[model samples]
Target: MTQPNTLPQVQPSTTAIHAGYTPSGDYRPLTVPLYSSAAYEFGSHAEAVEKFALRASGFTYSRTGNPTVSVFEQRAAALEGGANAVATATGQAAVALSLLALTQGPKHIIASSQLYGGTVDLLTDSFNDFGIRITFVDPDQPAAWEAAIEEDTRAFFLESVTNPLSTLPDLPALAEVAHRHNIPVVVDNTLATPANFKPLAYGADIVVHSATKALAGHGQVLGGVVVDSGTFDFSDEARWPQIARARERYAGTSLLARYAGGAYSMLVRSKFLHDLGPTLPAANAHSIITGIETLPVRTAAAQSTLLLLANFLEAHPLVKAVHHPSRTTHRHHERAAKFFPRGTGSVLAVELHDADLVPAFIDNLKIIALAANIGDTRTMIAHPATMTHCRLTPSQLAEAGLNAGVLRISVGLEDPADLIRDLDRALAAAEVSGDKSTVKDVVFA
Candidate 1:
């Protein structure tokens, strides 16, 4: 292991390329070689025992570790300015494992109401079976989070930039509140990739990503990662007994004592991942690594295109409202600008004059594809009210600022003119089908 004092600080772009792997002197492989074997061979019986004991650095089973996945994990950690990272089968698993690792017993979690629908389901439905309680609060109000936190509150969760609406939370202020209560802040940076935002840099304790999205940059892979900033002190036994207490399964070793700077990552990998077995495949890790190499360039182009499209749609007669932080009219515009000066992100939501026209508008688009996923090379659109946020109740939808007319667009690396023309034609088609009798009460502001 490289000593912390000897570690070199490099730019994210540089870290993406070279932080994880180095060619062996004999083989001189330029890329991270994929190890497909299910189990690695041990030189001796004693060596196998040592590997199982976690006394040696080597892979024993693919479910636990692999060379390619490790490279991806290391690179992701470096890019996010984290001490370590654990790759998982999907983004949802990353969120689940991170939270589960923190709370093994009955505990409380304060989460932003504006989370991804899938995440909302996990917290409310699935995790409730395990005696974990979640309290959802508005991301815009820091005081709400303060009031909602309880004695058992272990973590505060929110997205850096919300999924469809692009809402920005005061991360630094929230992190301060969480720290004051001895709780860690976990930020999901899937929408605002590390290329655009590093949550840890803004006082976030941990960062999570759906590598299937922007991190992979292509819609071809399914993966997720949990990164530990290594700044949160898990030595507080009362707050985080999972890390501070001795574990019988792992030879009675306390994770915090065993891995001081990387207690969170170590616990997640050794405990949750070991039992749950949500492993990222070696091939998928390779694809994500390749996708990450071009993330900066891809995200920049997509972000610029998103801004142009948002502006175009905001001025259009058929559009009722545009929800993007880049637009000055957005409620969180200033906060978004303060955190993400490079760009708010590639995703934006726009409301049409008629809720009934959403299907037609989506059906008429020629270039943009209709899909549930985001952060792809091709522009993608989805109706959040029916798709991503469908799980939420009617009241939840209203609180989230989503309506039946809202369309979520994930901008891609395409010509701005081509995308604009596609949307213009689609809007014209949608307008033709609109009921003139129902248009009187529709507000365009």
Candidate 2:
């Protein structure tokens, strides 16, 4: 047997590439094997009962747990410096499940005003219908979070770095406020990814990711993960009833009592994950796992390219403003330096001088594709007011810095010179349309 002391602790870069799987058998695979079976056979009836009861850790069904997904979850947890993690079918599912695990009905959540549009829809529509109350506060304001807190507030949620706009939330300050109020902080680190930042390192209690974006690197797979730091004091049973109090899911034993240091994730896996039926497929898990291996190198290059593009765009005559943390004029410039020393992940929002010429600009793009997804190997662009953030109200749009003239660009591994040429062409087209008598303004819902 290989002793634990035989190897020293590895770094995040090494962990991202190789953490979950180990080769031992005569004909072992070098990577995580895809376990596509719907269910697993138990060695004996006694073992089955133990597994079913959550006493023994073994997969009985893929819906709640699978070998491949488990590896992805574990690696994700390790990257985020979490106690454990749970994988879900989609990023939305992971966000929903994380909150659902905290509160049932008629509870409250304090979320950031800078969240993605779909998340806003979920909070205002589905969660409202489910009897959960949510108060959205500007992520920059720590006082707003404290003022919005309620006795029944279960969790505080925000993005480490926001979508469309690369806004940085003061994670440590927000975490301090949430902890003072006895609420746990849940951060969506999708945009930044662990490549640029890990929320747990800055005082976040739980971290969630849209693995579809950067973790999968390629846009081929869709998955999500929830990683808990295990540092939250769930001993306050009155506040965290699901974790501290007895539950029927694990045969009436409390998750905290059953799975010490991993109760939050255990509850998410055994209950919210089981009931919601958003099981991530083994193939998707495998894809995300493999994609994560190249995260560090991919992000390092892409972010450097993005910074150059951002500087170029900012100096352009047709450009109104550039929203990126690395820019010294940006609100979060110092915050980015403090938190994201490696570089902020390769996404930026640029405001054009003419909103009326947006269509001409979008139509002229050649290499940079017009797509809604980010963290891809291909540079993509989307107008937030007409695309991703279309549903956001005018006030919400203003708060998120999503004006009609702003374009969200996801920088990829493409050559910086080629991307610059494409941008130059697009901007020139927009200028030509402005010269004409006929104006073309993009419309949205």
Candidate 3:
């Protein structure tokens, strides 16, 4: 038999720098060339017609795809072990497009109660307005997920490692339930980058990311990606009408029959993304590409710093709880060990004993910036109740396990000792201003 042709597999770092692009012709550029043109010129009207009809593969419009964004998509897909990917303007758009493509009004989705406040808002408000119902379930309870599934349930959504808390979901258990009912599992792998935790390997059918966080590894650019594993069968017209139903525009050929394995992703691009239009600018895409090159190194360094901070905070007097699985006392400690042996991606939530000290604690931080971002080279902090999750109602905050006193810290590549010192000084200042009765000498493990 003739040898099956396969590209030699490279490691994650190698794939990040080289997978999606190749230098060609004289004066070959070292990086992906930014094709800034709004539209690609076609040789003839026939060729343009063919491209527009989805029968041909070529960049006809920037709104649909771009060279720089295509490179980001390809590189992201390779990293996640996915077949195809689409990059969006923000991670929120990626999340919206992923679910919108799967189902529409009158269908149902079972989502984890432990989710970013923004996501909860989208599902609870916007999606509700669109007539799609969502059921929030406790991710740790496998039975709850199974029980919540309805006849019109189209998808199961959850984060690989939860925002702020770093709590892990039972992906295998959740996927089993969703797959048993022919529903897809969509995971937001933002907090835990693919370098540390690839949701696809844990039975996720589709993976989404907020590239502004860990994938970019820098706080400069804003982007998101939706990756399709291409393993799930969407051939059942009865379930996934968007992909499996034949359309008059495609000459009665269904998207699944035409694109085969890539049906779901093609529909995402051609349908929702094309119309809604959250295109990642080519320049921004180029910057995100640069960020991805050092993903492996950046992830490891930041994760190490995070673990150190988490340990120190867990032992502090003013801290009531540290919500990261790296700690032995954490509820999901064993789950972290099983799913994330490398490390949980570097974001943790600390609940202070005195919620009144939050403003002072935030004010005293010298090195850490009080910002709403994660997975960057510079460490930052976020207040869930007052910042990211401020829009959520009291009931919603309780569902996500966030409270007024919880502060989310994202560790960067800074020296662990310096970060620890900053934290100590901040806590000390807050303690002196708010409560002195329980203040004690600082200690770290």
Candidate 4:
């Protein structure tokens, strides 16, 4: 077996293209190849015993690991500057596995208030029913995070760039707060994918990705990944009582001692993935792997185009406000400049003067597609108040800045001029009927 190499300090654009493929022998494939088998043949009973007992490493099932997924995991791990990664079925599954691996009943987690609605619903509602108590804080305030942590707090969660609103939190400060309490910090790096920001490099303990977004670079496949920085000392018995308790439950030693840097990832694989069964199929893994190859190029183009479009939209007469991290009006501008100075990423939101015009605006657009999914090669847009954030209550929607007049734009790899032209025509058509007060009330409810 080959020892894993220590991650080098490398540029993200370079890492995106070349981190994972360590080819051996005469395959000489240009792209990462997929391994389609469901199971692996054991060489002997001893080999099988070692694999089962974790005495040695090998793929036992494609649901857990396969060549295509391994390459994807390796590449993602390298991009996030983590020790290892486990690819899963969706971003929600990735979030579930990361938290569930370290916790069971009666655990506590501190999470950001400005999070994806699905995540808010998961933690505040469903996970709470399962005995996980969550404390929500404004990620904008680092002190709120420190104050929210309890003795039982196992993890602190935040998004690198918050969905829809485009808020960027102070990662280093948040990590410091979590580390002071000897807890791990897991940052959802979906919006700012490693091409723009690597949370682990800024002291985040673990990074989760919704690979369905920019990493996949297309809306065709759905997948997620959890990368372990392997920096936290999980076996420090005084700090991690759960790990100590876990050692007692199983015949194995403390996870830190048994698996070293890979303890969390291993637990996630053997326990969460195995029991929950949110495993990505081999075919989906193959498609996501192919999509990842051009991740850097597509994201770069998208970021640039979004900024240009934001500037145009901000000046347009029909638009009430523009919400992009790079915009001076954004509340999170300072944090965005520090963390994602290259760009605020491709997603932004526009609040219109009248909500009635939203449908007309969307339907009038020629170049951009009106769809719920984002980060595709083709530009897509959505009315989050009516679609993605529909589950949220009026007060909750207002808290997330997802009121009736708001519309989200997921810019794609398209000519900025053509996009602006299409949006110009659409905005004109949307406002042609004039401002209507009836559109101001809650459309989502």
Candidate 5:
């Protein structure tokens, strides 16, 4: 077999489909082969010893690695321009492992206030119980980010394109702040896949993706990956004492010292993944690999549909405002062009003129599914105020830019005219069902 190229030197469109694995056998299978083996037979006890001792590079356990999954990891790493990647059961696991590997008890983390609701709970409610404290900042305000950092802060977390509202943070500026403090910036690049954006290229130390989204464009697989650039200098004892202390646990070698370019990802696979076990199934890996092949084509089509949807909602009588990063009205429009120049992605938020009518409006939609999932081949819509962010307090939701009537939409590869017509029918019916007192609130200026 030819050695796989570790660097993301190929063009993204080509890399997405071909960077990871080469066809095997005389027939040259066009797709990666699914190696559904739990364990590999060793030549002898001596060969097994070397593999177990980390002295030789070879897979021993499916949990540790597999060929099919390796292809997915390598393909993701290449597309994101990272040195290496670790595939997980879901996007949430990817977030958990990145934080677990990067931090210890009593450590501090800084995150954006406007984030996926699941993330808010994971950081504020879950990790807090583990003795790790987190500070939520407005990513829109660069000063707030700087102010939130403390001496014990180990990582800075945020999304490239946020979930509820489509906001783009200034990745370079935020990364500079974290780097100056010797902290790693871990970005959730789920919304804007590598086709549109690569967080590592823009200065993120680690990039995590919900492969369940655009990477698995059809939404057929529930998976995620954490990619490491191997750029951060974790060996600087003055800067990263935890890394130095944890060396003995990872075969007596500091992760940063042993693996220069993909140290963090290696650590994640070897440590957290090996122990916690959110490993992806070989079958799921095969499904996602197939989904990745057409990512460029799917994303381009989705973006075009999203633009039409956003425009339609903006002009609709029942939509108060539309939130999309590319729109000049958005506070982060300039940042979006700089970071996600390919496009702002297919997800956007629409504020209803009347809060009470959103429920009826959603029920009336025929083509758009009422689902929380994003980046599917079929359009999905959700009311953030009630579904995704309901756990947050009113004040918290307000801070996160979520209004009571705000609705989120993930456009898909459907005919733009049909999507618009479905939405139009829903909005018209919603206007009639809404309370007369609240009718004015649902209409745009």
Candidate 6:
């Protein structure tokens, strides 16, 4: 088998389809075959020991590793220009495990104020229970991140393109601030997949994704991945003892010593996933691998449709505001243009004239499905105030630039004309219903 790293570097579109798999000899399958076995047999006891000691590269158990999942990992790592990758059962697990592995105890993390509600919950609720402290800072202000950093700060986290609002931060600037403090910048690239932006290329230390979204473009599987840029110096034993210091757990070998460039990803796989057991299934890995083959084309089409819809909505009298970086009215337009030249992505948020019109507007849409998930072949719309961002307090919502009058739309692989027509009808219906005092706030079942 040819290593993904050894394969000649190529364009992203070509790499998406042919990075990890290389069939040779008698069994030359055109596609990557699924290996569903829970365990693999070793040729001899010596070989088993060697594999267990990380001296050889082979899978022993599905919980820790699988051949099918490895292919997906390698492909993703190559696409992100990372040293390696680790796949998790869900995007939430990926976020949790990545942060958890970075710190052993009572550490601090500085995160962007405009992040996914689920991530906010994970940091403020779950990680708080574990004694980790998190401080939210406005991504627009690079100095805020610097001011919030302390000696115990382990990582700096932010979304590449913030959820719902489509806010694009100055990633390179924020990363520089974090790097100066010897902190790794962990970016959630779920919204802006590698097709549109590569966070690592812009100075980010780590990149993670909810592969459930754009990577698995059809929305059939749930998965996430963490990729390490292989540049962060983990040899600082005082700050990152897990990677730098020798431990008795794995034969007293430090990860940084064993895998010089891939310490972060290697530790995530061998320690975090090994103990936590949030393993990605072989079948799901195969499905995500297939979805990635068409990511560039799928994302491009949907992004184009999204820009058209955003423009149309902006022109409508009913829409109070449209929150997309592609719009000139957006504060982050220049930064977005510099980073995401392709498009801001398929997701955009629009604020209506009144909050009461949301339910009626969403219910009236015949073509767009009402769902929380994004990056699908079909269009999806959701009320962020009640759906994805409900966990946030009023002040937090305002800080994140989300409100009750705002609605998020994830454009899909549909014709712009048909989508525009459907949205036009829905908006008309909503306007009519908004005029009536008897209108209710209940969403359609």
Best candidate per TM-score, number? 6
lDDT tens readout by residue for model 6, 267-315 = 8999999998999999999999999999999999999898889889999
Counting clashing residue pairs in each candidate, in order, gives 0, 0, 0, 0, 4, 0
lDDT of 6 at 211: 95
Give, for candidate 5, the lowest lDDT window spanning 10 residues.
436-445
Q: Which candidate number has the best lDDT?
A: 6
Q: Estimate the TM-score of every prediction.
A: 0.95, 0.96, 0.95, 0.93, 0.94, 0.96
Higher-lDDT candidate of 1 and 5: 1
lDDT of 4 at 174: 90
| Global CA lDDT computed for model 4 | 0.81
lDDT of 5 by residue, 1-445 (tens): 3236444456777887788877666877777887888889999999999888777888899998988898998899888888889999999999999988887756899998988888888888889999899988888777788888888899999999899688888888899988888889999999988899989988899999888988897877799999988788787765565465456666776766666666777778888899899999989989999898888888889998888888888998878999997678998888777767788677989998778887789888999999989989999999876777767776778788888678899999889999999999999987888644442243222
Error of 6 at 200 (Å): 0.4
C-alpha local distance difference test of each model = 0.87, 0.87, 0.87, 0.81, 0.84, 0.89
Runs in model 2 with CA error above 4 Å? 1-7, 435-445
Clashing pairs in 5: 230-261, 353-441, 353-442, 354-442
| Steric clash count of candidate 2 | 0
Worst 10 residues of 6 by lDDT: 436-445
Expressed as tens digits, the lDDT of each residue in 63-100 for candidate 2 is 99888888888889878878889999999999999998
**In the order shown, what is each candidate's alpha-carbon RMSD?**
3.1, 2.4, 4.7, 2.4, 3.1, 2.5
Which pairs clash in model 1? Answer: none
Report the Cα lDDT for residue 214, model 4: 86
lDDT of 1 by residue, 1-445 (tens): 1111223877667776787887774677777777777788899999999989987878889888888898899889888988899999999999999898877777999999898889988998998989999999999899999999888899999999998899999999999999998899999999999988999999899899999999899999899999999989888887788888888876898888888978889889877888889999999999999998888888889998988898899999989999988888889888877889888668999988778788778888999999999999999999887888787877777777777788899999999999999999999988887634332233322
Models ranked on TM-score? 6, 2, 1, 3, 5, 4
* Least accurate 10 contiguous residues by lDDT in model 1: 436-445
Q: What is the lDDT of residue 412 in candidate 5?
A: 91
